[model samples]
Target: MSTTAEAPSSSSENPKKDTEENSESRLYQLVKNLTILERRESSLLELSKKRESFPQLAPVLWYSFGTIAGLLQELVAIYPSLSPPTLTAHASNRVCNALALLQCVASHPETRTPFLNAHIPLFLYPFLNTVSKTRPFEYLRLTSLGVIGALVKMDDPEVINFLLTTEIIPLCLRIMETGSELSKTVATFILQKVLLDDFGLQYICHTAERFYAVSTVLSNMVNALIEQPSARLLKHIVRCYLRLSDNPRAREALRQHLPVALQNGTFSKVLEEDPSTRRWLSSLLYALGGEQYNVGSNI
Candidate 1:
């Protein structure tokens, strides 16, 4: 009787073990294809671009359990590897695809405010903060900037206020200082959008310290482009300075401290073909004080 009872007990445990194994198999089956991530990003990118077609995308994905949270889980799971900076391209691409999804949410007006309310952008800072020069990290930083880029591109004051309350300005400035040319352009664009807003303009110009911080970065980028020129980047730099000149105090500061490169033919070669950028340069020079500053600009 003892042996019979023992055999029945052992058999019962085997079925439970098999069921657990089956559950594990089910999960692997569910998550097996990394392409699922890629496909989702592609879909969301289309949704962001043509949101009118998929009008209900915002609510469905925003409220879905595994949508944003699932995307974040992908990031948080890889958080450890970022410290020693061991994050791989495969992993970075995966997480960045998820980030691209976040960008979709951020771009959609319906989701942008709530996305900020929930502090979704905060989770991306670490990726932006990583100091690695490797392509993986650079791509991560650029994609991360794209999310912020989407927000500012809307020219919303509430978005700027949310950014001002956070460390976004400093973070973007750091990227402006250390990121790639494309990255710098995006970083500068965010700053430009912020400064374009009436409140953002006042807030940044409220203190001399803040004013100099942004001016210094724009000045540095102009200097760098003197050697390795990017017409796209220069366009935004000129626009940023032009916007800054809107503030009386900032305009006075620029009259004295604006980079000499802008006043001369330093970028004459690059601007020769970029009429729109040349126009921006003209507007910036005109705003600085007088048309005399446009002497050698060749704009």
Candidate 2:
């Protein structure tokens, strides 16, 4: 009797163990399938391979973000190791495919917040250093900046706070100075959005370190104006400066830099040439309490 009871207990445990093993196998297959899908390229059988993956990936990302946080960690980790940034690796193309998919996902308004909430900016900001230093990474850098710039457009306080407190201001200044015209335009958009609100101005003005960084940024923008007299970028930058000077603390911080800018005569020279530039420059000058436009004069 005892032997007969023991045999049934052993048989029952084996079925439970088999069920668990089957569940694990299914899970492994699911992960493998998703990973392959994320990196899939179009082939004879799969004409829209990458495009098809986005919709599939988006929901999985949305529903399973917390559970598979390591997927994001891996995504962020593999960025610098991609083709242009590094030589051909075993999975360079795959990683690039994944990042490109991510960029598409971020571009969607519905998916954007969830994607940003995953804290992708934290990973993305460091790539700007590579962008600043390497030619190969320039395209990657510009695309990355475009994505981050798009997130900034959301104007979420969490995103804005992260941007303001980081080295992003200095990085944006550097890109504006050294990046290609298209990159420069995007960098200015980032800068413009960053400094659009009182919060950004106050953030800069409240701290000596930030105020100095922004002062340097303002100087660089003025220099950009001098270099590219006809560039539309300078027009937006001039307006950005005027917005900065609106804050009392910012006005005071700017007061110290006004003399050097005015002394250079870049503004004076440009003022006579571009009417729109002149309007923004005049507003900037007035904000700094330096020069008032004479309503009756040619100015």
Candidate 3:
């Protein structure tokens, strides 16, 4: 050929890079706005007092908030290597702001569509592993679990499996084993969601001993539940114990707690009145007393 075809320009060859850079720049601007808004707390409070004063801006705020959440998720996913301890510590703080915005949207059903439709699961998924290992910012772990709980309530398998494979159950159990009552409560909530699936239930059964070894923590959690108004916490504890009893090691470890659980009327009430609880208890009892029920079977 008389003339060589011109080489494509770098920008032309890498359009995606330009698009990503633009997205990152816009995200930085949005985050800056959020920071400014947070710093002007009194102004926001004053604005809140003015009813319908900023109605026109509400949609814009919501959209920006959702976009920030989406951007954080995309950034984390595209650059997982950047989520090291130092970076994650900073990101966790930013996530707190994101969660506040999400909570505001969550409180108003009409404004919740953007979050419920997309932003929630996106923010939640990427933070799973990061939150698990972040120590000094432990609150982020509980916050992350709360987001997962919300997604689970929404019945999203994608969210559930993401949590499962992230080893969230083990991390939660470890936190519940060593952390405060609030931590245990948060962990229990996530575990309750996990127990909804058969594979999750089986996994808990298989690792029952590890969970049961933290009996002192479990006892404290049960005691704390007694003061709570909601019966849901007590019910979840019972279900967790019942599942654990399926494993021989767990059964032996929890044998000491059984009498206390029954005497305290936590398990007893459920065994008497809750049909699902009764069914699970029956299966657990059968599993624990295998020889008693399988007298005719060869060992």
Best model number under lDDT: 1
Error of 1 at 262 (Å): 0.5
Better of 1 and 3 by TM-score: 1
Residue range with the least summed lDDT across 10 consecutive positions in model 1: 26-35
lDDT by residue (tens digit), candidate 1, 117-194: 999998988887888889989998999999999989898889999988886888889988899988988999999999
Query: Which structure is stronger by lDDT: 1 or 2?
Result: 1
lDDT of 2 by residue, 4-86 (tens): 43445545557878986765554434434444545323221121143454344444444543423534554576665643557
Please report the candidate that would top TM-score against the real structure: 1
Ranking by TM-score: 1, 2, 3
- lDDT, candidate 1, equals 0.81
Using lDDT as the measure, what is the rank order of every candidate, best first? 1, 2, 3
Distance (Å) between predicted and true CA of 64, model 3?
A: 6.7
- Runs in model 1 lying further than 4 Å from the true structure: 1-56, 291-298
How far does residue 247 in candidate 3 sit from its true spot (Å)? 7.9
lDDT of 3: 0.53
Which model, 2 or 3, shows the larger lDDT? 2
